[model samples]
Target: MRFTSGTSFDGVREQLFTLGEIPGVLWTPEGAVGTRPLIVMGHGGGRHKKDPDILSRAAHFVTGGGFAVVAVDVPGHGDRPKDVELDRIATENQARVAAGAELAPLIAGFQALVAGRTVPEWRAALDAVQRNGDVGAGPVGYWGVSLGCGLGVPFVAAEPRVRAAVLGLGGALASAADAARITVPVEFLVQWDDERVPREESLALYDAFGSAEKTLHANPGPHGELPAFERDSALRFFSRHLN
Candidate 1:
């Protein structure tokens, strides 16, 4: 896999040392620009930044809406080269890995490890954005989905520069205390019948948010069925907070 940015956007560059030692795509709109809003986007479990489904919608956020977007490929997924895939660990007896039993700890560790890499990388990206001068110079925000949401929580929690966040189809951290640490306003977008992740977990997260400015949107549908709605809601929510 290779890290890539949209060639159509001007002032675009690829940052190699991003979260999880992955690559991030940075895109700035054409011609006139100065100190615009920045959004650090994250992909779902096994997708890349240029996922046809995601980038198609994301193009609106960058080119049409004029937001600088940086979407990173998570370690062991997307364009990042990986030695092993967790889901590939299947034996005769362990055909299906136990739900939370096998994945919870692994996901927790991945998020922690990824969070450790975010600050330095984000600072580097911020520095570059500032240097561009014509590009992003204002506050930053985050938008994430599925496993991305899991990582985004810790990312925003540690980096207060993120003014707001939009999380789609993902749960909060293991502890509400951890969730309470985030200071920015956040929007939790979830499907009521998400079978992959319990609906209760998302609510527990929404209920746990310590930020007084946060809100929760419970949309109708299942996990995969709601990505369109999630995208619209996230765009609107981020616009409200970022602007």
Candidate 2:
């Protein structure tokens, strides 16, 4: 990993970094000593590692909760060069949605194409960050919504290091088999009136999780209208499991 830039605010130190071709950011609590619990965050589709929502959540984890945070730009999002096929699919999917066409099959195909690449990239980011030796060793957790959750299900399922997760705002884009493989504690958020993801599919995705300790938080809102209280609840969940 190569360090690019850094800043500090309200006792949190945010650093920009690049691991090979992947561009990412790491946030550590100021004056924090030794290895602390680490939270690997994932951003929504069309958003990058530095999206305002992602930054806010990372700040909550590091500045308010004293956990280290890291987030990478997913392939074809953020700083990564666009994949022609993936871009084409995304464009077509948007057109279909605008035309009031069904989106599940198209979304499923896109997820299948991208999930394979994303899962390994997340693993690699974890490996590179651990090698840097500052984020602490207490435990690892994940927090991601929307596209983040779509890719995160399989990543967390495959990764043994993550002990807990915050996932939601995504439906059954990937296979239920992948969600069924995640055995760690999970807190899933569902927007009751989400326009993009159907309520039934979101509930079904939550039900597919293999974790014995899982909670579903459904609020009445649109896809981007997740309540602030839900984020507070998620912080508490991670604290209980990771701290």
Candidate 3:
């Protein structure tokens, strides 16, 4: 792992050498380069913007399997120029409070970020990673938990380059039409006891999958946590399709 530069956050270092203009933490082994399969890790909703768990997970893929990993701060959360605080409140609170006006914009801002995924900035980031030669030549993969899962939906749908994805603790059946657009393999992990996100919603999404390779795994855990076995399953799923 290499330390590139500091980002908007105090201790968060930006790994721009590989991912170019994309704002994220890039991790790869020493003397690695090329258009490797990079795992784009997204964070869950909440105050875990600078969470060590998410960062450590990215490092594991980089060091354990030589996969390039980039974890970006989704709009409305983290160090991005959005309403980091308002996003933490409950949805009901957001609907009731005047301060929640910022929350809607933050959500819209996140959507905009995903919509622009194919634009120059994101492409430049991909180009930078390819230039570094750390990412091996393979189909790219994406992984996210909670809110990151929401973002990854459009990401994989619009970006055909993302051949595989793993989403945990965040999913909703927006509609059959939107779900039909996802053409890649996706492994969705959900806990039966999750209170934050209804299990029915995830089931609806699982039913809406158009990909022949999609899988749904249900385990036991809270909305904010995942069991050890689920984490292993997630990594294995990514490795299988990403490599």
Candidate 4:
């Protein structure tokens, strides 16, 4: 990983970096002593690593929970070169959804294609960040919703370093079998009235997790309307596991 530039604010050190082709940001608490926990923050589909919500979550984890946070632009999103075929597929899927056509198949296909690229990119980011000795080696965790959850399931399952995870707001786009391999503590969130993900699929995804310590947090709201309190809850969850 290469550190390109950096700035600090509110006791948090924010740095822009590049891990090979993937561009990303790293956030660490300024006054944190010794080695601190690491949290990999994932953004929703169509969002970048520096998205406002993602940045806020990173800041919360670093400043509030004393963890180092990192986020990378998923393949074809953010600063990465856009894939023309994927863009066409996404547009087609949206049109199909508007016409009340079956969306699950299209969504799953898109996720599969993207996940193939993203899962490894996430690993690369983790490897690159860990190479920075200053970041320290501590318990690692993941925080992601929607597309983040879909890609993260496979990534976290394959990466044994991640001790806990917060994954949800996504459905059965990827293989539940992949989720079954994740045995770490997981806190899964679900939006009761999500317009995109079917409620049954969300619950089924949660049930498919192999983690013995998994908890489900469901609330009434649309896909993007997750309660802000859940952020605090995730922070607490990470604290309990990583600290």
lDDT of each: 0.66, 0.88, 0.62, 0.88
Error of 2 at 53 (Å): 0.6
Q: What value of lDDT does candidate 1 attain over all alpha carbons?
A: 0.66
Full-model lDDT, candidate 3: 0.62
Colliding pairs, model 1? 35-137
Q: List the residue pairs that clash in candidate 4.
A: none
The runs of at least 3 residues in candidate 4 whose Cα sits more than 4 Å from the true structure, single-residue gaps closed, are 31-33
**Candidate 2 clashing pairs?**
35-136, 36-136
lDDT of 2 by residue, 1-243 (tens): 899999998888889999899999999988667888899998988899999999988888887678999999988989899889888889998999899978876776687678899889888889888776677456899999888888888889999999999999888656578999999999999999998888988999999999999999999989978999887898899999998
Structural similarity to truth (TM-score) of each candidate: 0.79, 0.95, 0.75, 0.95
Q: After superposition, how far is residue 169 of candidate 2 from its true place, in Å?
A: 0.8
Taking the tens digit of each residue's C-alpha lDDT, what string does model 1 give over 20-99? 35566666665545788888777776688767655655666665556777766665667667635343442311443443
* lDDT by residue for model 3 (131-184), tens: 555464567887776666666676667666778888766545433344578878
Model 1: how large is the Cα RMSD against the reference?
4.3
Find the 10 residues in a row with the least total lDDT in model 4: 128-137
Off by over 4 Å in 2: 95-100
lDDT of 4 by residue, 1-243 (tens): 888999999989989998888899989988555677899988998999999989888888888888999999987799999988888889988999899887766776788788888888888888878776657778899999988888788888888889999999877656588888989999999999998889988998999999999999999999978889998999999999999
